[model samples]
Target: MCEANAYVRQDGVEELFLEGVDKVVPMDNQLYLENIFGQKKMIAGTIKELSLVDHKIIIEKI
Candidate 1:
């Protein structure tokens, strides 16, 4: 199962939103991933568009 992870973006601060994620669904640079121990996290990015087709998740990052 694919799950979303949360991120905190602050001014003058840069961080890797997705790194070493276990459940990473790495396609189109979109991650439906989870933590290392199979824990579900809150959705982070602002989703403008979303679609699920052919076992894929397409989203527009805002």
Candidate 2:
């Protein structure tokens, strides 16, 4: 229930990247994201914002 949805922002638009993200790890130049369902993704971006109250995470591509 504490998991959050991740989004990628581009050109002022936000797109859903992943849902139910439970873990986030920064490795080198990429960000690693994992969901509660065992889903995983590695993205070349930086964190833009994290809204814990809204359960949202925003990432900006490099």
Query: Model 1 lDDT vs. the true structure?
Result: 0.41
How accurate locally, in lDDT, is each candidate?
A: 0.41, 0.97
What's the TM for model 1? Answer: 0.30
Instruction: Quote the positional error of residue 5 for candidate 2 in Å.
Output: 0.4
Best by TM-score: 2
Report residue 10 deviation for candidate 2 (angstroms). Answer: 0.1
TM-score of each: 0.30, 0.97
Candidate 2 per-residue lDDT over residues 25-58, each given as its tens digit: 9988789999999999999999999999999999
| lDDT (Cα, 0-100) at 30 in candidate 1 | 47
**Pairs of colliding residues, candidate 2:** none
Model 1, 1-62: lDDT tens per residue? 44333343445343435433445444444446666666543343443322232222223343
Q: How many residue pairs clash in each candidate?
A: 0, 0
List the candidate 1 regions with Cα displacement exceeding 4 Å: 1-7, 14-20, 25-32, 46-62
Candidate 2 residue spans exceeding 4 A from truth: none
